[model samples]
Target chain A: MLDVRFSDVRLPSGPGVGYKPQHFNDILKNAFPVQWLEIHAENYMGDGGRPLAQLRHLSERFAISVHGVGLSIGGEGRLDPEHLARLKHLVGWLNPASFSEHLAWSTHDSHFYNDLLPLPYTDATLTRVADHIDAVQDAIGRRMLLENPSSYLAFEESTWSETDFLHELTRRTGCGLLLDVNNVFVSAINLGYSPQGYIDDYPLDMVGEIHLGGHDEDTDDHGAPLLIDSHGCEIVDPVWALLDYTLEKSGPKPLLVEWDTDVPDWQTLAAECTRAQAALAKVPA
Target chain B: MTTQSDFEGALLDANKPVPAGLSDGSGRPAGRRYWVYRNNVAVSLGDALGTGFPAISKLVGPQNFKNLAAIFLRQHPPKSPLMMHYGAEFPAFLEGFEPLKHLGYLGDVARIELAMRQSYHAADATAADPTQLQRLGEAELMTCRMTLAPAVHILRSAWPAASIWAFNMVPGSPKPQAKPEDTLITRPEFDPMPHVLPHGAADFLIALAKGATFEDALKVAQSNAADFDLGATLNLALGHGAISDILS
Candidate 1:
């Protein structure tokens, strides 16, 4: 068996916040014990800028992970060589402690939508995803972790459960899993599944990183509950509880607090990181 | 089995009343779910543009930016999956946009920002050692073919774009009085820095960027403005780390 160990991952005990350029001075001045800092890979793709300067400074001071929103790894047609080249360049440049991307597809033909769209979980889809992952890993010269996406609806064409699809993809491509507990909870609530059951059956050994974020709850026109992974607000109480349950089962992993929209001040996010740390402390690592 | 064409068809046209490629377990229409996918596609692309061009967003309020982005997406959808480099043609779009023609400087401002972004993401290269200039005789130095780093970008504008960009970035900064200004953007280190170039600097840099020798570039600069100072021009290029190679 290949030695795929995530023992190097240094997850925050409680909630951690996304790094914002607004807090550049604050981060530089204060030695905040935030568990880790997660950055959107595309934002710092520049060869040189304040973003790269700040990220390079912070990476030396804290555990850094590159979370990519653009790769469109599951997109139809051939994988984008340019996008893969950029990703490889970034991986070579940063040598981040961990790297991850969404399972959703965001590109079609040559046009990039820049959104993570849902994919049908079928045998053919799994094979395509495995091939993509394999290509990405080969390009970057490092293993990547794939995160499960929060879906509003499931297609009837899906022949496998989300868990089985992710597990099989990891098994086939040798990629790690970035088990987004918030997504699992949101998808379960929207698609009418037991979140607990899904968590219980997940491939825990493959999970290298965890994501906690907020979602919007609304009812569809037909009155069916719909949950959207907005990541605009704080991690709600239910998602927090779900994260706690997931950590208990998966053991301690790198947990990221993702709040992309309506971002609060640095301290407010730092406080959330403290909460994540406290949650992880409750788990016996 | 989903072929590449099937997947492409489904994603390209989310509003395809009855999508040809996708089907639910039963022989039923999956029209409603397509809406979710479509919304995600539009929102994310718009957001990417907004994020990449925050200055553009601020210049044109959120509502206008959204409207502009909607049109721009259809006309110039991203060619690459990388969002950072997604809106290269936005400034060009703004140039021809009917609604934005009233703000003549808006396109120039966008061009300035785009130049800054382009310089920021341009490949990293070491600046030519200043000591090399000392090795050449005065005549040789004047005629030396210097290579400007690819990271250096010079943009000419009829509006004071650098001043405008500074005002927008700095809070409580005075609104820039509309005046024609040329701008220089260079990434000496990791971040791209923008500065207002003195008169004739744009012509000089443009000449150099076109592979002109130092003397030839100086002639272009002097012709553009009789008072063009060679020392000042060289200082500006050297200060920004734009000069990367020199050959006798």
Candidate 2:
């Protein structure tokens, strides 16, 4: 197979919402200010369904971004050829403006855990992750944006920081960063670090898309603050503050408001997009 | 460097010790963080199962259901990224699980729910026109093979599986009687409907799905139930748009 490169679109300066099925008819019936729409790549992998049909309709109007959650690009094993082929088929059919996946692994030993599992940032792991990303890019024939993970813990053996690791992946694979701001806040607070410092170390110039989502705050063992990337509720003040802090440096990018669990009505989701748009307006695109 | 398998095995099992050198980058053990990951994986997969089999979850209660779901995830993790297709083997798993032996009917009820999920994601097919069957000659109709919709499925059980599922799922439902029942899943619209498959109608539909001609299916159905109401069964299938084609 030829290793052809497909240039992905740099999303226009605005905000979009993670497309939810509940809001499909509403979106079709009424227009919202959300300039683009993003969907999880795994959800539409089925042969034929309302999801794909809705995506086909939405793609005609919005700048579609295919965000994948099940790629397992950071797993130790090579990327699953079957999953890669499905993704390739989906991307080929959709020709999405932006394609992205997580920097975490969700599969091992042919069984998908269905949750983003964290990884240590060591040289060997970095090499393996880079190779996996390269394979994904080569298979899809399009450059993908890798989103940083929201983790509750870190590894002592991890020699490189998360920012440095992402920087390395970007340099080696020539892929762009998704720069999930909510994940930065969740991980930094959970790991007892400065979200600002992490953002500073991040190669902001390489970020092609941004994500903002809600988080659930709780206390882990030993009474330390722990935040779960639930995406179940409204965006909190701290996460919005982190998004503001990020946009001030990274400027306006293609941002998305993701609320997957306990999804509210279209108006409620669009309200989050409005908030994102208002915030983006502050950052002079 | 630890293998991915080592990390995932620890992540899935809460009792397992974290791999060596796994820390919180603060010179402390990563035990708590590892538990957090473990909880995430178990809870997410549990939630998926709970969503897929709501009636079963309700039958077992939330706490017991959650524990069973956690155990099930460890035993049979998802193979596909599509969560819709996650628990195909769950029915057999329930049947073999010793703890749930007393509730033998639970596995059959789970089968009904699984059939519903499959029907929801099945290929879209146009319902067969009533005229196609009405115009068939007597001999031709008897020899014709009924092509069922991809979203159509029939589940037969010795327990009142369909009634139990409906009682647990819907409000204001009548208490289920301890009688054998069968279910027919048909997705005539966006949502899949699980209808009680009147007596031997399930056997008839099953035979048709297996490519048996109308005559053979009716014979088998009659063998199963001597007084099988062919008119009622025909009305049910035709009314629900379960049949998508017919071949003479």
Please report the candidate that would top TM-score against the real structure: 2
User: Highest DockQ, which number?
Assistant: 2
Candidate 1 lDDT tens digits, B1-248: 44434544545454445444453223444446456666766787788788777777888888999989888887787887656677889888998998788877778788877777677767677888877887899899888887788778888888887788788776886778778888888778867778788889889888888889888998999988998877787887887799888888
Q: Can you give the DockQ of every candidate in the order shown? A: 0.44, 0.54
lDDT string, candidate 1, A1-285, tens digits: 653433254544444457888877777777364657889888877666567778888878777888888888877677878778888888776777788899988777677776787788888888888999999988887788999998766666678999999999988999999888889988888777899999988998998888888888776546667778888878888888988888888888777888887888877777777778888889997
Q: How displaced is residue A183 in candidate 2, in Å? A: 1.3
* Candidate 1 error regions (>4 Å): A1-17, A28-33, B1-33, B54-60, B123-137, B158-180, B187-193, B244-248
Error of 2 at B177 (Å): 3.0
Docking class of 2: medium
Evaluate model 1: give its lDDT: 0.78
Error of 1 at A138 (Å): 3.0
Give one digit per residue, the lDDT tens place, for model 2 in B4-111. 777876877767788776765566666676777787788888889998999998888999988888888988989877788898888999999999999999889999
First chain TM-score in every candidate?
0.93, 0.96
Clashing pairs in 2: none
- What is the per-residue lDDT of model 2 for residues A1-285, given as tens digits with 9 covering 90 to 100? 532334345567798889888887888887467888899998888766466668888988888889999989988887889999999998888888889999899888788989898888999889999999899888888788999999887866678989999999999999999999899999998888999899889999999899999898787666778888999999988878888988999888888999989989888888888888899889976
